[model samples]
Each structure stands twice: as structure tokens, then as C-alpha cells.
Target: MKRIRMIIAAAFLLIVAPLVFSCDTTEKKVPYFIINVKLDQLTYPVSSTNKLYAVFFVNFNWTTPWLNLSSSRLQIITPPLNIGDFPLFFIVFYDADNSGTLNSGDIFQGWDGVIVSGNNLTPIIVPETEMMLLNVDLDNNGIVP
Candidate 1:
């Protein structure tokens, strides 16, 4: 009788232990809001001092109204620049009221001007919101797309 009881208890513990340990009741997938950003011009030269512009459209269908759209950050990725090179600037626009026009105050500006003598350029995000126009001066004289 003692042997039979021991076997049953072991079997019960083996089955219950796995069930208790493997159960996950947490929520996994959190839906993210999608925003589409496009460049005004499709192409740019390798080395030039041309003005680059981009437009961003925020799709609020999946996003809640409580979410802060204006406070979100913007980023740009570029290659490493040579010594004493000028940084690239980015202008971001947001239509918070769903208006068809992007007004003067609707613009967000940022720049990446760090001179790193390497092959890869790190991504930089502008922390300021006052500047809207990005003036990118490629020091390498290479046309950047």
C-alpha cells in the first residue's frame, strides 16, 4: 500500500509541476501604431549641398487618442563623416489636427553632425522641436541619397 501511494503521489507531482510552471497568463502582443514617412525627392546625389525634404503621415486608426503623437521622436541613419564635415539635418512634419496643410509650426527639426572617421555612420535623433528645416552639408562631397 505504501509503495502504491508513493507512486501515485510522484505521478501527480510530475504532471502538476509542469502544468503550473508552463502556464503563461500574461498579454504578449501589444499593437503598435503605424506612421508612414516619405521623402519629397526620391533620389539625391552622393556628394552635394542640396536641400532634402521628407513628409510623414500618421495613421491613427490603430492608435488611441490618449497617446502623445507630438511628443514622439524622429531618427535618421547615415554613414560616417570625415573630419570637419557638416552634419545632415532632418525636418519632420506632423499633422495633429488632420489638416491637409503642414503649417510653419507643424515642423520638427533634427541634425547629425558628429565627425567620426569610420565606415559606419550612427543614427541620430534630434531632441529639439523648434527647427523645421534640415540643412545637410555632406563634407565627403559624395552625393547622399
Candidate 2:
């Protein structure tokens, strides 16, 4: 009976060893985009209450979360993206009423057909990383839509 129990234990170890040891150790590579916005402070001064916000869109189908803009030079980092080229549209707005959406008193700036590719997600140079630089002056260059 002891010999039979030893054989059963050996068989159990043989069956479970591979399953316990072999695990998927590969890390997932998540792609992200970055945008550096340069605000023109002379025309539209940065105030405490009235804040700036940015949103990215693709054909009005997909939109990213609202990124708060604080300083004259602001960097926006996107979430993970799938592997493909996307024609992205960017909007930087001044929230006068502190509401998230666009309203009557709000001023905005937008750029269309900004193509970004996901293939070169990981770049070598940090300063020369894949990013878009936007110069925004809400008072002078604000768009209605």
C-alpha cells in the first residue's frame, strides 16, 4: 500500500509540475502617443479659475479623456493604442464655465488630419520622441467648432 501511494504521488507530481512551472512570462507592449502644447501667453493669459483642456479624436468615432492644461508648455500622454496608423484630431479649449463640454463662452483651437503611426511606439531619443507640438492662442486663434 505504501508503494502504491508513492507511485500515485509521483504521477501527481509529473502531471502538475509542468502546469505550475510553465507560465506566460512575456510582457505586453502597450503603445502610447504624446503631444507637447505650446501656449501663447501674451494673448491668452493663464488664469487660476479658467483652465485649459485637450481631447484627441479619430473621425469623431473615438475620443480620449480630457487632459488638463496648466502651464505654457504642457505635455499630454495618451493611453495604450493598437498597432495602426490613426488620423487623429486634436482640440485645445479654454473652459470658461468650468464645464467639461464646449459652451458659448468657451474658446477653442483644433487641428485635423494629424496622422500618428503606432509602429514606432518605442523610440530611442526621449527628447525626439514621437510627439506633436501645438501652438495655441485661444483669444486670437480660437475656433467656433
Write out the backbone clash pairs for model 2: none
Across 37-79, the per-residue lDDT of candidate 1 in tens digits comes to 3323323221122222333222212111122222222322323
Q: Estimate each model's TM-score.
A: 0.26, 0.45
Residue 139's lDDT within candidate 2 is 42
Model 2 C-alpha lDDT per residue in residues 106-138, reported as the tens digit of each score: 676564322222211122122323443444444
| Model 2 misplaced stretches (Cα beyond 4 Å) | 1-43, 60-75, 80-83, 112-129, 137-139, 143-145
Q: What is the C-alpha RMSD of each candidate to the true structure, in Å?
A: 15.9, 8.7
By lDDT, who's the top model here? 2
What number of backbone clashes does candidate 1 have, counting pairs of residues 3 or more apart or in separate chains?
7
TM-score of 2: 0.45
Q: Give candidate 1's whole-model lDDT.
A: 0.33
TM-score of 1: 0.26
